[model samples]
Target: MEAMPHDPAKPEFTPLDVPPGGLETPYGILYRPLASGLQILVLFAAFIGGPAFAWVIGQVPGDLSQTARDVLFVPMVAIFFLGYGLWIARLNAIAFHGIGLGLLKALFKLIVFRRKPESVADFIPSRDKLLEMMVRAQQAGSSFAPVGWLVGVIAGLTAMLFDSALHPAKLFLLVGGGCVIWAHLLAWLGRRNWLPFMESE
Candidate 1:
């Protein structure tokens, strides 16, 4: 009889097949390219649009003092960030039930009490521990970024209020440097999956 090649006694196990469209979560559909593109577009629009709008408004005639413009501009920037965050949360919620409302409530609680839910899984995942961690980390970073900006703005503005003699060039450099640092930090976090909205394939 011809020798036969021995076959393995057991077949190797394969991982559970993911759905063709990838996983769905309460926050949104977790598809790759589309999700990534939408997130980039939204973030870019908000960041750029905020400053541009502020500049346009500042140019309008009113003889508004520079301090007043600075104050107004800071709030406008904050509003852009807030609006974008809420809109994206809502868009994600449309895929799953109550996620938008839940997110808003949770955000309010966190802001008011500096308290987080006992478990993020309660919001992002019912069963997947890994996914829960990913979502929570991203959400935390997202929340922190705006707060950090706000803190910087408030401090800068407070100093300007007390001493209007602060050099404009120095102030511009400080703010610009801080913004550059923030952008780089956010980019790093996004690469590490810390920024959920900025996550890509």
Candidate 2:
């Protein structure tokens, strides 16, 4: 009997099954799930703080003079975008699904878009040497947990206080209270075992 040709549009099937072991990367790194505490903190900051800060900006009075509004909006937008980009990058690092692919996307911009080095550096990892340092930090089980989170929180609180006091048209109570609500949600989620692992990619 003659064999029939397979259709090109049809999908191919493989008998192979996915292994349960850690995921391996072409760079020879095996990405694994993150610790519970780390996951909670990561997600909490991204989901809660990200939106709250945006909300506060939205609440800023539009009636302010153009120059004043522009002055405030410029910094607010910069911080919002920076926080959002970092959040996604950190999530991908832990998830193993974001690093190489994300890097490739960034590289295209560098090549075709004529993006500046400093801007590229912000999105991409430093040089190969710096990436090596990051990998070493990951392998040694040493993380910046202790003071890193504390400093970030303190800095955020300080910024909030300054923004409230300086921007008379902004509703200080709403912004500050929203931050507290965001933090409370994070603690609640962490306690409920709803957080995911957040280790580096």
Off by over 4 Å in 2: 1-49, 60-170
What TM-score does candidate 1 get on C-alpha atoms? 0.32
TM-score against truth, every candidate: 0.32, 0.27
Best by lDDT: 1
Whole-model Cα lDDT per candidate? Answer: 0.47, 0.42
Question: Worst ten-residue run, lDDT, model 1?
Answer: 192-201
RMSD of 2: 14.8
lDDT of 1 by residue, 30-114 (tens): 3332365665665575466546655554444345468755654564465445534643553354423435555676788889999
| Model 2: per-residue Cα lDDT over 1-201, one tens digit each | 988997544433443222345334333343343566787676666555644564454445444344433333333333333433443455455434324655666678789997744443444443443334333323322122222243334434544444333453234433334434443444343323334534333
10 residues in a row with least lDDT, candidate 2: 139-148
